[model samples]
Target: KISAIANEYGLSVDLQTKVWQLTVGQQQRVEILKALYREVDILIMDEPTSVLTPQEVDQLFTTLRTLVDDGLTIIFITHKLDEVMQVSDRVTVLRKGKVVATILTTKTDKPSLARLMVGREVIFRLEKSRLERREKILEVNNLQALNDRGIPAIRGVSFDLFGGEILGVAGVSGNGQHELAEALTGLRKSTKGRVFLGKKDVTNSSAREMNDLNVAHIPAERIRIGVVPALSIRENLILKKYRHSPFSYGEFLDNKEIEENACRAISDYHIDAPSCETPVKLLSGGNIQKVVLARELSENPGLIVAVHPTYGLDIGATEQVRQVLLAQRERGAAT
Candidate 1:
């Protein structure tokens, strides 16, 4: 979050370096330092604990409490009910761009605060379950890929994605998971070995070819590569299938068909756009990702390559995405 603000202010130090090398508390401190270094008077942080552990969150709250005592105004943007109750002094609940309520935190608890935040009664918990086992759906054989600097990003990594399992790739960031996802999605070409998808060799396939073969991709950096910023939401929705049949009529352009398709995608994805013609650049981060996921998952693809799928999304929206993926997996889709 600080990285975005620092980029806005044109701070020169490397954000990647800070994220790669620092501890959780140290990383949060770097964000504070980046704000201070850039001479930012108003610090805005959004959903800060999405990546942090419990102990690290406590340390960060301590730091934030100290900073608040020092008279620094932090516009902490968060949807985590417990965090709001614990850290905030005064809470301002905004529902659909309007401030619904603003009250002292001392008088409120998590449930009361969440009710104000959403303007409805909300459940703030999850019910756990054990999943059933199934057959292996994907296999990676000695796959290798290079980073932009020509260094080996993923070194001989092999794994199997089962039909009815949510196999987690657990690690710190930049530990080759991003590259692995890219390689699997055919966005990043592999240099060695092959990727087998149910008896087919897809190692050297392009993203378009992979999509044709039922490979869907949700990129990690959606703002950079997922959507065209200058295009309208409707235009961006049909990007993957514009040149194909039904969306296109021989050589002549089908603007009406394109509009219909885009509207369908927007409605199916539940994109909160005022109109289909609105530019995607105006949507929030979660909404933008919703568009990408909608386009990718609509085809009921055989393989889904999700890179940080829940990043920057609210709990409800994240759960929605998770349910979609799980439903796909249950229907024999591989990840």
Candidate 2:
């Protein structure tokens, strides 16, 4: 019956696959599958299309329309104005904790909705300065890696990234993007290949070793891999650099210094929280991502490995994130 229902809804995730091994998009499909298995009449989907491919998104819209026609109700929550215009019958715009407007989706356009959500004119286009293409920062030669399921994920990958350059790896979500990022950041070991940091061969180094080498990573799974949710924002900001001077005094953490660092990050990153003492789990997804960025980019890393950095972020926050990366590039950092 489960299989039948999943097929009926066009849910195509592998039942035997481990959740960790699955891509974000596949995991999202599994979540919808879980809901379908329970036979719910109403579904609440938040950022459903964020990780999905264009084709997957279209299929999802078709499925949603079918479900609606068959007397199912869906509460779709997303920051994407176009998705709202496309999928929603009625729209409710929220800013801070208040609802700015709740009207029929057909009655309003994208521009008006954007202004309502942000309380200002929000620019969609971002201008990035030309890449300087300086010295070689990273070299991956014949890199081979396996996924969590012990299946070959990264297959003989090779690339060179230069300082002040942004290299984009384009592929479908399940096609080794995570494995490659892990291999580069030392979270996953490559079976065969030499990874060189400048001239130094640092193949299969530990994650901590990579951190010590000033390698910055913006992981796709924010809550799982990015921040420690139970900890305070202050502690998470100093997660990487806490072992060093000023942040620590022998076995004890320097509370004043930690708080000061947190204050600077909170202010600079524009993180919306009650205070630095607030737990990361309480913050929104965008704020949590800001915390991750603040921690990773603070030391001015030589090489940054970012995977879907601005996924699920609103228009304003997305623009800000891109500008920050461009600024890092301006400092001759490899991205």
Leading candidate by TM-score: 2
Model 1 misplaced stretches (Cα beyond 4 Å): 1-32, 38-42, 48-71, 123-135
Question: Model 1, range 1-335, lDDT digits (tens) per residue?
Answer: 56664454332245566364433333555666666667566778877765554665676677677667768888888867778878888898887789988989898887676667655666555443556666666889999998655678889988777665666776654457777887887788889978888777778788888878878888766787789988998788777877887778888768898788778877877788898898889998778988898778877887788877876776556656777787877677777
Q: Model 2: residues >4 Å from true position, as ranges?
A: none
Error of 2 at 318 (Å): 1.5
Best by lDDT: 2
Question: Candidate 1: what lDDT?
Answer: 0.74
RMSD of each: 5.1, 1.5
lDDT of each: 0.74, 0.91
Estimated TM-score per prediction?
A: 0.80, 0.95
lDDT of 1 at 176: 72
Query: Mind giving the per-residue lDDT tens digits that candidate 2 earns over 186-296?
Result: 899998989999999999999999999999999988999999999999999998989998899899999999999999999999999999999999998899999999999
Q: What's the distance in Å from true for residue 281, model 1?
A: 0.9
